[model samples]
Target: MKSPETFEHLVRAEFTPKSTFLNTATNALLPARTVTALQDAVRLRAEGRPLDPLYDDVEASRAAYARLAGVPVERVALGATVTLYTALIAASLRPGAEVLTVENDFASVVNPFHVRGDLKVRAVPLERLAESVGPDTDLVAVSAVQSADGRIADLPALREAAREHGARTYVDLSQAIGWLPVDADGFDYSVAIVYKWLLGPHGGAFLAVPEDFGDLVPVQAAWAAAEKPWDSAYGPVAELAHSARRFDTSPALFTYAGLRASLELVEEIGVDAVHAHDVALADRFRAGLAPLGHEPVPSPGSAIVSVPGLGRLQPELSRAGFALSDRAGHLRASFHLYNTPADVDRLLEALPG
Candidate 1:
C-alpha cells in the first residue's frame, strides 16, 4: 500500500487539520502543490514574466487530462466550466429532438438544451431516464455519479441501452471522474469541472470529444477555436479544429496556472488508487452511519455518501466543524485523497446515535 503521506502529506496545513472536511461534492481543498503553484505564478507575473508563457499551461493541463483518460491529447479541450461543454454538445443536436436526463442533475446538463429550444429536454427521475430513451432520443445525458444521491450509474448498461436505440451518450464526470476510473468507450462526450474532484481552480474544465467526429461543427466557436488562431483573423472564418481543441472556452491565462499542477498531481496518484481510497472511506462512513440509523441513498459506490432524510442534522454537524452538503433532504459526505480514518472518526463522534 502506498503510504498515506504519498497523497495526504502534501495537503496544506493551512486547512484546519483538527477539523473533518468531506464536502468534495461542493468543492475540494486545494493541495499545497496547487496553492504554491498559483502563488508562484502570480509572483512571476508581477515580476514581468509574459502572460504568453502561461498560455502553454492550458495545453499542459489538456495533456494531463488526456493522459488520465488514456486518450490522445487532441481529444481533450480545455474550458472554463462543464456547463459550457454541455452547451457545446447541445449545439450539435438536431432541432426539436429529444434529450433525456434526470431532473436533479446539475442544471448545466439539461438547461442548455431547454434554452436552445432546438431540443426537447425531458427532466425526469434517474430511474426513468434510461427507460425513457428511445429511437427519437437524440442524446441521453447523465453524470457518472449522481450529484445528490451519490448513485453510480451502470455505464455499460446505459451505453448499451442508448446504442440499441440509435442515440448519442454524454456523461458529466463532475462527481466521479477523478475518483472513479471511467472509460470513454461508452459515451461520445464526457465533461468535467476541475475545481471539484480535480482539486484545481474554478476556471478549469475538460471536454473529451469523440475521436471519430465528422460533420460536427464547433458548436460555439471562439477565436481560439480557429484552426490557426495566431495566424488567422475574422477575415475569412478559419476552419474549426477537427479534434476537440475546437471546443476550448478561450479561458483566462491565470486559470491554467494552478490547474496544470493539480491535473498532474491527480495523474501521479492514478485514478484507480483514488477510487479505492474514496470507496473505502465511503464504506467506513456508511458503517458508522448504520449505528446512527442513517443510510446512504442509492447504495454508495462513489466517494459521495449521502444519508437521506438526514438534512435536519446538518446544522449540528456543521457546528462541530464537519463540512458537508445537505441538499434536497439528503446529507452528503464527499471524501477525497486528503481525508483519513481519523476524519471519519471525528464525524462519527459528532453525530448523535
Candidate 2:
C-alpha cells in the first residue's frame, strides 16, 4: 500500500487548487497531468505548423482508448458523448416510438428523449427493470452508474433484454469509466464524457457503436466527418468517415490534446488499478461518514459516495476548509486518481452532525 503522505503529495501535485475538494454532484476534477498536457498542446498550436491535419492526435488517442476498452480503434468515435447520444437519439427514433429508461438516471440521458413530443417516454421502476423490457420499445437508454442514487444497473442484463425486444441499447458510461470495468461487446452504443471519471478534458468524449449498427447516424454531420473534409462547405453529405468518426467531425484540438494526456496517464496507471484505488478511498470515506449518522447510498462500482444529508452539513465542512456538494438533496463525495485515503479522513474529520 502507498503511504498516506505519498498519496497526498501525489494528489496535491496534480490538482493545483490543492485546498478544494471536488466532492461535487456528478462531476469530478480532471487530473492535474491532463491540464499540463493541454497547456503543452496549446503552446504547440501557438508555435504553428505550416499545415496540420484535423484530428492529428486522433489515431494515437483511439489506439490508447481502444486498448483500454479492449475494442478496435476504428470502432470508437471521439466527441462529447452526450452530444453524440443526443444527435443519435434524435436521428434513431421516429415519431411515436417509445423510449424506456429508469427514473433515477441523470437528466441528460432522459431529458433528450422526453423533449420529442412525438416520442413517448416511460420510466421503468428500478425493482422491475427486467419486466419493463419488452417489444414495442424503440430504444432503451440507461446510465451505467445512476447519476442520482449512484446505483449501477446490470447493463449486460439490460442489453440482453433489449436485444430480445429488438430495441437498441444505449449506455451512459460517464460515471463508470475509469472507476469500473466495462465490456464493449455488451451494448450496441456506449457514450461517455472523458472529463469526469476518465480524468480528461470536458470538450471531448467517445461514442462507441458496434459495426453491425450501420443504420445509426448523427443528425448533424460536420466537416471532419466527411469523406473529403477538403471538399464542399455545405450540403446533405453521406460520404462520412469510415469509422465512428462519421458522427464526430471537425476538431476540438485543444480538448483532444488534453484528453490524450489524461488517457495516457490512466493507461500508465492501468484502469483496473485506478478502480481499486478509488474504491478504497470511497470505502474509507463511507466508513468515516458512518458514525456521523450519515449513510452512503450504494452505487454500482464507481468512486461516487453520496450521503443523504451531506448538503445539510456543508456549512460545517466549509468552516473547516473543506467543501461538499448537494445534488438532488444528497451530498455526493467523488474520488479521483489524485485523491488519497488521508483526504477522505480529512473530509471525515471535518464533517459535523
Q: Which lDDT tens digits does candidate 1 get at residues 138-202?
A: 88988888888788777787788898998888898888877888786457888888888888888
User: Lowest lDDT 10-mer window, candidate 2?
Assistant: 49-58
CA error at residue 101 for candidate 1, angstroms: 0.9
Instruction: Tell me each candidate's TM-score.
Output: 0.92, 0.88
Clashing pairs in model 1, backbone N/Cα/C closer than 3 A = 96-118
Give one digit per residue, the lDDT tens place, for model 2 in 154-204: 776787788788887878888787768788666777778777777776677
Question: Relative to the true structure, how large is the alpha-carbon lDDT of every model?
Answer: 0.79, 0.72
Error of 2 at 262 (Å): 0.5
Best by lDDT: 1
Which regions of candidate 1 are displaced past 4 Å?
1-18, 233-236
